[model samples]
Target: MNHFFRYFVVGGFSLLVLSCGTAGDKAQAETVTERVENVKVSPLKTLQIDREINVSTTLEGYETVNIAPSVTGNIEHIYVEVGARVNAGDLLVRMDQNQLTTTKLTLANLSHDFERVKALSETGTVSQQAYDQAKLAYEQTRESVDFLSANTFVKAPIRGVISAKNYEDGELYSGTPILTLTQTHQLKALVSIPESYVPFIKAGMTLEVTSDIYPDVRFPALIEMVYPTIDASTHTFQAKLKIPNGDNRLRPGMYARTSIKVGEVNAIMVPYQAVLKLTGSNERYVFVVKNDSAKRVRISLGKRVDDMVEVFSEELAIGDQLVTVGQARLVEGVKLNIVK
Candidate 1:
């Protein structure tokens, strides 16, 4: 019995010693955590930083025109194909018009007869009634001749490359866009501005644009037009910026990002991570340290670019040191340890 008691007492003392060591360890951890939870804040600084806002957009043609058939006829020949570079009045397509040629020949004969009759009337060999009738016929026949010749030939309206051709040779084409030619020398960046910004948008202001297709390329643009009124449904005003695409790099239907200078002012801004998004959405909070205790400050946030966010609220003043590096682990009235 004495030996069993001795064994039991020794085991119990060992267990007690182990519990005490664990408790000491836990208490030390709690003390270290308390010290580290302390926070520090500095005054905010007012800096004159150039503000840049990024917008998503695409490049578009300044002017797009469809080459619809002005005269009715069957396609006899196609002089140009897609991507063919042509100047104004260059032949693009031709229509088969046997009847038109025949009509022209008939008109020519009538014109010659009418001229002879007019000459006879001047010589008093023909009656005035005959002369007047012959004169009218001659003018009418001349117009017919010109019309027929035009119907047989298809021509380019301006200097441009044929981007599209809808009709094939021997296909009947009438009043349909046989080809689409665009002068890509100039491009336009289209954008819609909110109603609040309409008054500030002025023509001749500069714009900068970029596109995903050409990541390294930036096109200098100018404000071309601002619509006079706002769209009722969208509550936005339409705006356009012109870009010189003489190199043909900026094509129609290309996605572009456009930036316009709206306003510039000095505002208080801090590191992006300093502003906290609580509840994961619209709620914004920032930790401001006062006397080693972190005060959770709810801030009204504005434009942000890269790692900095603009804090517009009056609660944050210039030269106020913000806890930028370590803010996520803090709560209201929590303490933080400033490592730096």
Candidate 2:
């Protein structure tokens, strides 16, 4: 009876040990099963890529004029205030007549002396040298008077709005600018494009421009000027576009974005959403399916058109399935299940 009891106890212990071992084996097998992520992918393709470049710049006045008095004097009267629209040659300010009046008085005296000296010299009453001196003095005084007279009435140089007023009536002019006039009927957008695009950009090319201030408005601008020289350090060239602000709604110093169209080319294009930027770095990458596994590929990006982008990579080839979805949860060498 003791031997049977011993055998039963040992058998029970052995069965318990075997059960634990089987359970561990089952759990281990489950843990080792390859974790496959279900993803949607599209094959890369070669298409005629619309190579367009976008540049941001500020809108400047086509013509900016600074108004100031040529001679130092007191501002007598201001005809226009800020935001007042004026035409070219419009009288904007009038300086005090103190300098102009005094010059005219001197000119009158010089003229009287000149005429008297000429008459006396002709009659042999005065020397030729004295007559010549009086004539020269009169001419010089007349020129001074003319200069002061023209400057006394400060006129607008350009037909535009009065952007600024620096002085009021009865203020002394210390050679500071009294007003700033900007031509708002037409504005210019200066953009610096990559030097490689210089050969393709022409002076008459039409480009699309948008302003932050006018969000819903997109206007066409012509490339009025393209700088001949390229900046060596920046490897960029400047292009000026004429933006017509006929309504006088656009102002200078507003931010503008310009899109220039380059000719089409055959290139590998992918969806813009497929491109992923790695954390803590500027490097861009995308996942592609290779032999049923996800392969992360580093790529150089070019101009993006709408939802698609131009991409270049030595490791990538045409018709390779790219994993656009489920990429956020994928890593290099992860197994993939292509799903519809």
Per-candidate clashes come to 17, 0
After superposition, the stretches of candidate 1 with alpha carbons farther than 4 Å from their true spots are 1-54, 124-132, 262-340
lDDT of each: 0.76, 0.87
lDDT of 1: 0.76
- Candidate 1 lDDT over 53-79, as tens digits, reads 456666776766687655777888889
Every candidate's CA RMSD: 13.9, 12.8
lDDT of 1 at 145: 66
Measured on C-alpha atoms, candidate 2 has an lDDT of 0.87
